[model samples]
Target: MSEKQETPEQRRERLRQEEGRGNPAGDMNDAANRASNGSLVDLTGSLGWKGTGILALFMVLAFIIYAVFFR
Candidate 1:
């Protein structure tokens, strides 16, 4: 039987090396740049009109159904 042996420091070093090679910070920076450059649209203001209309429609329909069936 062969046993794999790895010390805690060796495991930590391996993880650190892997993370450095993966360059997650660079990916985050790219994402931030894209977001700041308007590649992503700001939806908070538009949602007030569209989402509110949909929600109000849903509430009206729910009230109509409840009145017809439950009361």
Candidate 2:
């Protein structure tokens, strides 16, 4: 009898398949839903609105500053 252990790739593939069968990107989906990936890094749903608002505010503030000081 020959002994052949499962390769790392095989194990990973099996685990991935099981993951798909069970939850289909469950952890990633959960992390995204929970806003766990951070706003600066991913900004997916975590910082979208806030980031946009901040950017708009900064732009308006910069324009006002430039109009007052530079122009």
Task: Please report the candidate that would top lDDT against the real structure.
Answer: 1
lDDT of 2 by residue, 1-71 (tens): 12258654456556656776777678567557648545333332344677768877988999999999997
Candidate 1 ranges with C-alpha deviation above 4 Å: 1-46
lDDT for each of the candidates?
Answer: 0.64, 0.63
Assess candidate 1 and give its lDDT.
0.64
- Lowest summed-lDDT stretch of 10 residues in model 2? 37-46
Candidate 1 lDDT, 1-71, residue by residue in tens: 12248654456556655776789887577667868785312332345567757867988999999999998
RMSD of each: 15.8, 13.3
How many clashes show up per model? Answer: 0, 0
Model 2 score (lDDT): 0.63
